[model samples]
Target: MKISPLRSVRVTRYVTPLREGGSLPAIVEADDGFLYVQKFRGAGQGPKALIAELIGGELARFLGLRIPEIVFSDLDPALSRLEPDEEIQDLLRASGGLNLGVHYLSGSSTFDPVVNDVDALTASRVVWLDCLITNVDRTARNTNLLIWNRELWLIDHGASLYFHHSWENWEEQSVRPFAQVKDHVLLPYASRLEEVDAEYRALLTPEVFRELADLVPDEWLDDPASQRDVYAKFLTSRLAHSSVFVNAALYARNALV
Candidate 1:
């Protein structure tokens, strides 16, 4: 259950924006001489998006899934001075503090289910994780998966854990069935939902939930530590209601049977 703490890096140079989404994620070079897909804390989605990315990415690693390395990236406010684009400059100015960095995958291709084949177990686990976290963004149109070195890797988890948007009554919604699971891109390939439930469920212990939740930076959250406790409680509740999500996924995939 033990894992290394997230590494921190300073952005050395500004790169092109991905521009595919509203958050305006960018490809940047860091002090470590590595490229990172930077999620700005100043983006319209706010720090909560980065928080979701950290929590979801770490939890995936704990479950032995292939996720890009996440880091607490430092963005220098003065870097904005070099950007001529007013839009990006504003972004840099707003996000002059801590941002989220996803290790850039070089020579990777977007995963298109139409032409690619994914094994059942891998597909099932991915689908189950999405459902468990109430991540509704991994649909056919936006798989949020990449094929790097001929291996499937998950990315863009900023939309998961939607309940965190409203800390008010978040606990009550934690146990609710993750309905968007029906539209999951992998559901058709995930034929072993029940098996996935039995095997993967236990891996996410209460301790793991708390541990992963604690990974979020204190500054990003309004009440800092209180948010971590809330996240832990919500995740632990979701784990306890694992069956509800598992069954819902199975029922949604029943069309294949």
Candidate 2:
């Protein structure tokens, strides 16, 4: 299946800083008259976080998971001048180019694992996706999930695909089992991992990875050593060794329960 490119928009207004995470993402209004949770390119993690957000979110969507619509939002350096906060001013100046935005879910609340009960299928899928991407932020502490319109939605994938932080050993990292699965928020409920694994594996192909990689903006992959193809190659290699992480999750879940 061919994936469509993300929508592009210009930031019309900066609403407020989220302040929850170190990156200082904010809610901003785009030219399209919609609010988006904008992930700035100039944040502490730099563009790699946005790249991870794009690839991880799109990959989950491709696997039939619910993800907020991701968009390419252009930030104007002039917008920073209007802000009184020197910190935000610096952020806007640094993120003057293309940034990432997630369609805001107006009244969504963070997922509270204790207060909410997820079905086996949804839990399995979430766990499986996290494993496939080596996402480490979905622990009990910070689920990075939301309940919007009475449905579970995944967001904030910047912490996934962390191997890119140090590309020197990306090949080995691709196939490594994610031991972090033991701390996963949904691990206890992911009883259907074996079943979901078989299904999701068939959905993720090399072509699919390439298509997702293509969605990433050329500007985000500006690192001299990291090209767009590298993203595709990393995921494709990881998928080939899916069983390694799949088994790791299964083991963690068993130990947990």
Candidate 3:
């Protein structure tokens, strides 16, 4: 699939801080007159987290999953001056540049595993996508899912693609099974893994991976072109050996059932 470049918007107002996670993402108003959940480049996880969020979220979207629109948000240093909190002020100052934002979903509630019921097909697709990306989040404790307009929406994928955190032995990491699948919130409902696996594997081609890699911004990477190549290589290699993780998720689901 040919993906268009992300829309760029400048942050016009420094809204309230979302203190849910350690990274301190905020609901900021953009120049386009839209509120966004802005993930900062200056956060503890740094630019790498934004990169993972972009790649993982877009990949989910490409695979027919619901993800809030991701965009390139420009932060201005002057926007921090009105903030009383020293820490937030520091964060705003540090994040002055290109950051990541997700279009804020108004009135959306967090997906509670105990309260929500997901269909086997949806569950299976989510499980498969998480396994493919080696996402460490999405456990029962924090699903990172939202129920907006009564539809499940995936979010906060900064915890995915962790192999990039330490590039050593990244090739080996690519083919490994995701043991965390056992703790996945959707595993119990994912009865159609085999079916979803077949469909997703076919949908995500080498070209798709390349396109996803190309979507990442150059400023985020040390070696823009080469690192993009590395990301594509890692993802394509993981896709090539998807069965390793697929079987792992199947075993986990079977155990849950």
Best by lDDT: 3
Give the per-residue lDDT of model 3 (tens digit) for 160-207: 999888888989999999999999999999999889888988888888
TM-score of 1: 0.98
Report the number of the highest-TM-score candidate: 3
Please tell me which model should have the higher lDDT, number 1 or number 2.
Answer: 2
Worst 10 residues of 1 by lDDT: 200-209
- Residues 62-91, model 2: lDDT tens digits: 888999999999999999989999999999
Question: Which stretches of model 2 miss by more than 4 angstroms?
Answer: 223-226
Q: List the residue pairs that clash in candidate 2.
A: none
Model with the higher TM-score, candidate 2 or 3: 3
Cα lDDT of candidate 1 equals 0.89
Q: What CA root-mean-square deviation does each model show from the true structure?
A: 1.0, 1.2, 0.8
Model 3 is weakest, by summed lDDT over 10 consecutive residues, at 1-10
Local distance difference test scores for all models: 0.89, 0.91, 0.92
